[model samples]
Target: MLRRLLVSLVVFLVVGAIGSYGLMRNALATPICYFDSVDEVSVIGQTGHIHIGTLDNVNAWVGTYLIDLDFETAYDVYDGRYEGYCIEDIYSPDNEGGYALYDAEGSSANYEAAAYLFNQYASSVSSNAERAGLQLAIWEAVFDYGSYNLTQGNGNFYVYNGYLSSAITYANTYLNSLNLFNPDTFNASGYGLVSDDNPLSLDPQCYQDYIIANPIPEPSTMILLSSLAIGLFGVFGIRKRLLRG
Candidate 1:
């Protein structure tokens, strides 16, 4: 009877560990989302295509949406569809900061601001104009140095609109509405940075970010799951000794 109890407990632990590990794997995995479609007439594509990447605050996000590779010059990646399994993060640790995000010493800060921008004002985007505006707002936060302004550089960091345009104007509206809203205070847990090196983006002024309704578990949850296996082992040892006695 004792041996049978022990076997059942061991089996339960094994099953639980396997299930937990599978869940953790799915949670920690890099997210996969579809570009779906875009309202812009970019040469990239009207569907399953978008452009985004950044280098720093000093350099403009030329044809960038969320993932630029360097600061020496904005490398354009305007060729892949990135529909199902064509996107990848070419982040190199020793590429001399081959990416502007890290070169400018503001990678984390940029993402925080970008994430905030997405969370704060990405829901009402129903048109190309709104999308452009949101993208511009995200860029302002991402390329932000010590201050936040989209029109303050010799031409490197300056972007403007001629009339009552929706893109640029809407972006300013986003910046203005969130005056005291600190990006640091924002909680960006469910979202992640999606990047691709194929089919570089075309126009930087019309870049944008979109949403997908898929959420994954956090890193902490993964830790909790991993710890379960060790804990179960300990419990099993204690039970085995007790049963013997």
Candidate 2:
């Protein structure tokens, strides 16, 4: 009878451990929270697409509705000072098209906020940063294209497809120039730096998830999970023997 009880406990524990592990895996697969606006701004979405935009404080806001990267609410990368923020134009041909580089003017004390963002980007040895830098280069390229358009006084709007194609190539050149990423190995899957070299094709969420998920798991959670799994297995073994008896 004692052996039977032990078996039953063990079986129960094994099932529980399996269940818990499954749960953890599922949770890890899905994001806890996507992007959201911090300010009381109305998000306007593009027809037949996931893109979103808001007019309020649009100049300073940095986020995307489709591949949500709300700098205001999520990371507060622009709380005090302004280095730069990722932005998309609602009126542009593609929501993913167009980007900017902004720096706050004024005293040094108020600019650390921007510094924080730069540091975050500059310090990271991650592939995402390499891709992000590519996107930044693309943005610069597009901006230059627009400036040319303006200089020529062409009232027609600029499309992004050609620029996007060229931007990827341009970015690769820049990446090669810096020798931060491999020219031949760069792909756009957001897997690692060189694996995804196409900067324009990068999904913002993919980049964000890479940043959020790849961080080392907390020691406390690891300990808890290990303990739980061990306890569960022990109980399961006990339960199996109990049932046999």
Candidate 3:
């Protein structure tokens, strides 16, 4: 009876190990692909205000802003005023009755706020190259925020709002704590695209293309591997016991 039990245990463990290994192998072999050939120009030129369904949609809006505002002014305004507003305040259903950005009936307060800030600081920018660099940085930050929110949940306004608030707090604290905005200490490329041109034109689909190129590792791969290891260990231990018996 002892030998029979050991044999059965070993068989069960072997089967489980095989199953887990198969799953892991399958997961490893199949790579998930996202938007690869998305046209950057089309993405940037999109003027129709709509809900952000994907990173592409967000990119389209960003592209529009890039075209509309000078890079330096856009950067200063976004960096300064982004913290003052929340995604919830910008897109909340309550504001749908009034003026809103993406909603049907409301006015686009978010764009207006950014524009106001840009106009306020536009005169301060001296160099076109510097402005372009700053614009890229702002775009990258916005893209990062939009991408993160999308991952939390597709079209989840609450998640996006909370994330936006937290991101602003974190960025402001980090920038202020170190007083790191000086040109000598700052690395603008780390933030976004840098260019020598007066107005930087970004491919509308660049963000989505980037996402497709860099696929995050699936969490399930680790779980499957762990299960496989446990199963193999169990099988090995049971076989050893059987041999002793």
Candidate 4:
């Protein structure tokens, strides 16, 4: 009887450990950021900076390589701080930044600029598919840097790490979907100063968007279910052994 109890306990511990580990692994695989209402303003503000900065950086990187445009010129086009031909002027409100070029349209000037740049770069490449691929790669790098900066930067409160984590999660999903960063083929030579160490999965973003779109089992819930399963299996196994004996 003692031996049987020991066996059951051992089984329970082993099963619990396995279940906990599996839950942890799953949690790590699909990181979810949890936040309270207080974090909304900060998160939104930081995300905005990330978005604008990324656009400016991508324009700079691509324009420098393809058209030999200087960094200051590229910066002025996207950054609202400067006057004339600024993309922010078209999309955001007057109080938000620069003067509006036109009445608010379907797409913002930021996106318009991005599309224009993509087309310009695409025309330079001989292969249509390669051109699309290169554009995607540049976009991916831009977002990757944005997400990385948001998560790692000192913009948000350290206690509210979830805000940054959420940002990174969203960014990762968007960038990963593009499928442009294959280790074998992607060459970052002319793509500005994109760090080799910066990978997509590490950064997280868009938690609110992601959570609404994808509702997955919580880690606690998963562990609870796993424990219940282990208990049931142990009970059944013990009953079978008793019957056999």
Candidate 5:
């Protein structure tokens, strides 16, 4: 009986391992493609959370952020959806929404600037004013590129609330301090795009700008690999016992 059980277990694990690897490739590849159904906006001293339905036809929890990343649906979408694009898509050829970047084009500069801005100012966002300011600054980074002034214009974004002007001004201070919008000093391979479904089919500027970081789904991957190792170990122990018996 033990021998039979061991054989069945081995078969099950081998099959599971294959399926898991495929899922991992789809889930981990291309910056983890997702539809991002939830849109929880950030409030004063409080951050919003969102749930995602990944492209693998699996609904996985990505991460929690101050503002949800989406192309169209607006629940807590910092501002209304506008025609926007982030970085260059070097990962997915079909334009599946979660593509990677290399700081190559205007889109690249937009996201690179946003990445730099987020790296600098995202940690100090304690108040809603600071939150609003940081978000406004990110928008400015994506839309206007090198410009720092937060005034509304023909092809630029203004502060969502007139009251949050100082917060934005404060946000711009750090970017000015660094002075590298597309700073090639650090690696941006971990950053990926978060856009609507098939954004490339349109003019590529008919959606809100958003990005999905890489560290979000790491824990689940670790867990999957660990389970496979344990299963293999158990199979060997069972086979040894059966031989002795």
Candidate 6:
């Protein structure tokens, strides 16, 4: 009976180990590939709104903009404004909304508000357990965003368009260098070909963008490996006992 149990345990462990190795290998083998094309464009002439998404999907969150608002000083704006609130954006929050700077003549107040808002919500839903409420929080946050607005001659908006453009260009170049294939395109709802003037929810433009695989490891494989390792170890111990006897 003991011998049979030991043998069974070893067999199970070997099988599980093999399976885990295979899965990890597969993930590594099929690297996500993006097009290896580099389009060098100066950030000087480019002017448009960029957006970021809540979920790792196609739709971008509203109210967020790719402006260089001094977040360090005004970072507390979003925290204080949305403190103790679980609600989300049902509309575009203009708080993070700021116009693109062409000749450097716009208010940074809205941009600052927008940046602070983006950091607030983006950091909030960092975990999978909390991500479910992200959509609601975002919508609620948008209405919260619009509460702040930019008016004429309030301050210099001075959108760092050149910095934004450089970031995008650098991202494209890096992806091209990776030689990765089958890359998924990131498109934000607030500013893109699919943008709606009065979008239902606010999605902001991305300050920077790139693709990354889901961080969480596979649960199934983890369990299997644990079970297999324990079983094999138990089996080896029994075999040693038998030999000693």
Q: In TM-score terms, which candidate is top?
A: 5
Q: How many angstroms is residue 165 displaced in model 4 relative to the true structure, after the best TM-score fit?
A: 28
lDDT, ranked from best to worst: 5, 1, 2, 4, 6, 3
Candidate 1, poorest ten consecutive residues by summed lDDT: 97-106
- Model 5 regions more than 4 Å off: 1-31, 41-107, 152-155, 160-162, 197-209, 217-245
Superposed Cα deviation of residue 219, candidate 6 (Å):
3.0
Estimate the overall C-alpha local distance difference test score of candidate 5.
0.45
Worst 10 residues of 2 by lDDT: 188-197
lDDT of 3: 0.28
Candidate 2 to truth, TM: 0.23
Reference-based TM-score of each model: 0.44, 0.23, 0.20, 0.23, 0.46, 0.28
Task: Write one digit per residue (lDDT tens) for candidate 5, span 55-141.
Answer: 112211111133443332122222232211222211122223343221211235566666666666666666655655565566556
- 171: Cα error in model 5, Å: 2.4
Error of 1 at 103 (Å): 16
User: Using lDDT as the measure, which candidate wins?
Assistant: 5
Candidate 1 residue spans exceeding 4 A from truth? 1-108, 145-156, 189-191, 194-217, 236-245
lDDT of 6 by residue, 80-148 (tens): 111111122122323333211110001122222322323334444333323322222232223333331
* Tens-digit per-residue lDDT, 71-122, candidate 1: 1212222323221101112122232211111111112555555555666676
Candidate 5 clash pair list: none
Give a tens-digit lDDT track for model 3, residues 59-106: 212111211111122112211111111112112112112110111001
Model 4 RMSD in angstroms: 20.3
All-Cα superposition RMSD per candidate: 12.1, 15.4, 19.8, 20.3, 12.7, 18.8
Candidate 4's residue-wise lDDT over 155-237, tens digit each? 22111233334334443443444334233333211111111111112132211110011123334455666666776688679
Provide the lDDT at 229 for model 3: 77
lDDT (tens digit, per residue) of candidate 2 on 1-245 = 66675566567656766665456434422332222322222222111111122222222212212222233323224322111223223332122322211111111211222222233343342343344443333232223322222111222212233223333343445423332322233321111110011232223422211111111233234545666677768777876876887
Q: Whole-model lDDT for model 6 versus the true structure?
A: 0.29
lDDT of each: 0.41, 0.30, 0.28, 0.30, 0.45, 0.29
